[model samples]
Target: MRTITLCSGKGGVGKTLLATSLGRIIQRQEKCNVLLVDLDLSVRGLTLLAFQNKYELDRLPFSLTDYFYLEDEDQPALLHDLHKGLAQNNSNAEESQETTAQATAGPSPYERLDGLFILPSSTESERPDWTPLHHLELNETIDKLGKLYEFATSSLHVDYVIFDTQAGLGSLSLAATTLSDMNLIVLEEDDISWRTALNALMEISALNKRLQQKSHSYFLANKVSSSMLDTADKLKAFSFLPPIPFDAWVQKLFAHATTAVLEKDFEQSDFFKQVESRVWQELAVILGARQRTTGNGPRSSWWRG
Candidate 1:
């Protein structure tokens, strides 16, 4: 299984949004099993994004916290059980009263897709005691995280494991970087964001070089205001993925509980189409998805919501 981690040197650069959207796209278009992991220990962004209906309340018997704090003797058994559960727990929910938030039929676009599972961080109400994590040595904790994700990819048999990492240069982020097959460092079209992202890219690149690891890194510039002049020229040095414009509609969509797949007009929107094209070109190739061609067009069918 290939693992990709979405991280940022600084916060508020739209990491979680891109992770969810990309995961959804990959699952639908590639027809592969994906596990979306939320490694942002402090901020439960992925949890909230997947926290719409009551099905996910008891979807998984354990959270990431549970995995970390469990006794050593029990950890292996629990991990084994978690892996076993992966096959039984299909991410897709059939159309039913329990699955629907509104009076709609079929799975909601906001929910997880078929073969695309989410391992969300513990919510505020269900937050586990973090004292154990604090007591563990920093390096040990980082190694543990890396091992946990490795297990997800190896034992869970997922085709892709996407990590929504915490911002900044913390041990957690480093652990994720060390384990990822590819890293996407997200930034904004501002000086501060660019500076931090450059620093992060350097650090990640250097670490991989030192370790002799085969991980690749990419830059993603997000939320470029339409009024901002010469945005492309400014970000040229970074060789960033297509820059996502700062649209008020997109901001509002993320402000509430929503997913990009739920955007009914996604295929029609020029911005989303561009983003999708880049994903198919760069991310899909990195993940080793064979480019399929049909009589209609080169890319797959447009998203139908």
Candidate 2:
């Protein structure tokens, strides 16, 4: 399975939203199973958005947090439990005599959309204890995450694994980068965002060089305005995806909507249209979901030094 990670130097750049929306789009277009993994243990943004129902969130049998702390021998059992729990919940939901409105509202956060599944970061009611993660060595964390990736791709039979990683160059984010086939470094037009994004790019480049891996990394300018497009294009020596323009409607919708992508209005919004039309096409090419002609093949390798 192909892997992609949406990472940023700081929070609030819309990584979780992009991850979820991209998974839905890919699943719908490719007719394949796509897993959306929340690797951001600190805030659990994707978890909150995906598991809108508190009952379901509390009922989750396992999460990335639990997987990280468990012994290697026991990891497989947790994954099995997770699969069983999801299957049982989905089966029960299907049998309910709920109204058509409720039924058509959209898939439950567990399986938010058909062929789209989410792996939450944690199931804890309160703040998760991150002390355990802090103690693990960097390589150890990557090894554990690699095993999780293998289970999702091989056993779960998912075609793609998209990670919504914690902001910044933290251990988990770095590890996710190492495992990803492509890393989308999302940023805005602000000074801090630009500087931090540059730092993040350098870190990823250094990491790839040290490991002798050629994982592609690209810049994605989100919430851009007409005036910002010129500035975004001025970034030196980095490949860029089509910029997703700022949308006032979406900004207001996020205030009340549990998950924007599931909302009917979002489908009509420019942000959604741009992602569906522009961003995914570029991503499909980079992820090998689509073929690149000989003339354009070198574009994929431009990310490397």
Candidate 3:
């Protein structure tokens, strides 16, 4: 399975949003299983979005926090339990409830969507205990994550493993970067964002060189206004994915909605259209998806676009 990590040097640049939207788009378009691993231990943005239904959030059997604290010998069993929990939850969701309206409400919050699975950061009531993570060695963290990666790919048969990492160059973010086939460094158009992004790029480059890894890295400018397109183009050190245009509707939706991708009119928005038509297509090619043909025959690559 190919792994991709979405990271940012700063917060609120839309890493979690991009990760979820990209996973949903790829899973639907490619007809393949995609697992989104929430590695943001502190914020847990993906976890919050995935478990919008409080029942599902409280019922989750295991999470990344639990996995990290477990002994190596017992860790794999937690994943097994996690898999069973997901299946059981989906099955239970199909059963009837007390209210007629509830019975006909369709799939539960945690029900499998096509083939999109989310491995949440934590299932804690208020906040996850991140103390243990700070004590573990960096390599130890990466090793544990590697095992999780193996299970997701071999046992779960996931085609893609997308990591939603913590903002900045934290241990979790670095670990995720080490394992990814591609790292998308998300940034805004502000000067601080750009400077931090450059620092992040340099760090990733140094890490890859030290480990002799060949992971590809790119810039993904988020919340770009029409006025900032020229500014974004000036970032020439690393290749860039198509910029996600600023959408006020999306920003508002994110504040009140569980996930922007699930909003009623989200798919009709220019943001979603750009992500579907441009971003995913570029990502699919990089992930080695076979070229697809449309009514107009094969489409051109991102460079041509």
Candidate 4:
């Protein structure tokens, strides 16, 4: 399985939105099982998005917080429980009366997505106790998470494991970055966003160098305006995702905590279509879902150029 983490240097830059949308895209296009883990302990936005009109956090039986504090020997059991819970939930949802094609019919880009699941962080966990790195040694926390990753990929058999991590270069964020196979640093089109994102990109680079592990990394510029695309294009050295332009419709969805990718007419929208054309294509290439031609023959790579 391929593991990707979406992180940023600053909050409110749309990392969770990108992670959710990208997960939907990967699940639909690749026809694979995708697991999204929200590691943004301070803000549980993914949880809010997933169960927005369905269930509230207080009603859920468990959350990722339970896994974080478990002993190493005990974590595997918690992981298994989470996996089983999700499987049961998916099965139950499928057994629910199916909506006719007409009911679901839409040009929505993500309407066809399936086999996607989200494990949201616990709202019960206080902010003071959120960062595992602060409570434990960084290397120890990284090792524990690495082992969890191994179990998820090997035993769970998920095709894609995407993590929505907290912003900044905090210890947890750094550990998550180290554990991820690919890191997507998200930012907006403004100068503050650029400045913060540059710092994030450099931190990732330095961490990779220190770890001596080469994982694919890229910068995603969001909320781009038509006038800013030219200026955005001038940002050097890093690969980019298809910049999501500022749209009033998107703002409304965000305000309502709605999943725009799953909404009607998403396929007909320029924003999501651009996402498919640019981000999906790049993701496919990175995850080996598509073959790349080279002098040696067709091969797969995480590098986007």
| TM-score of each candidate structure, all chains considered together | 0.76, 0.85, 0.83, 0.78
Candidate 4, position 249, lDDT: 69
| Candidate 1 C-alpha lDDT tens digits along 163-234 | 898888566676777878778889887788889987888877776777677677777877776766256535
Candidate 3 worst ten-residue window by lDDT? 92-101
Question: Among these predicted structures, which one has the highest TM-score?
Answer: 2
True-vs-predicted CA distance for residue 51, candidate 3, Å: 0.3
Runs of candidate 4 exceeding 4 Å displacement: 53-56, 59-61, 71-77, 87-113, 123-136, 234-238, 259-261, 264-268, 292-305
Q: Is candidate 2 or candidate 4 better by lDDT?
A: 2
True-structure Cα RMSD, model 2: 6.0
The sequence of per-residue lDDT tens digits that candidate 2 reaches over residues 1-305 is 78899999978998988888888788889988788899988788899888777777887778988988788889878976665544443433223233222333334345777778888888865663455355557888888888777755543457788999888878888889888899999998788997898899999999889888888888899999988767665642358887888988778888888576665567788888888987898778877788755333635446673
TM-score of 4: 0.78
- The candidates, ranked best first by TM-score, are 2, 3, 4, 1
Evaluate model 2: give its lDDT.
0.78
Model 1 residue 294 lDDT score: 30
Per-residue C-alpha lDDT of model 4 across residues 126-156, encoded as one tens digit per residue: 3554454345567776786676667554433
Candidate with maximal lDDT: 2
- Evaluate model 2: give its TM-score: 0.85
In order, the Cα lDDT scores of the candidates are 0.66, 0.78, 0.74, 0.66
How far in Å is the alpha carbon of 187 misplaced in model 3?
0.2
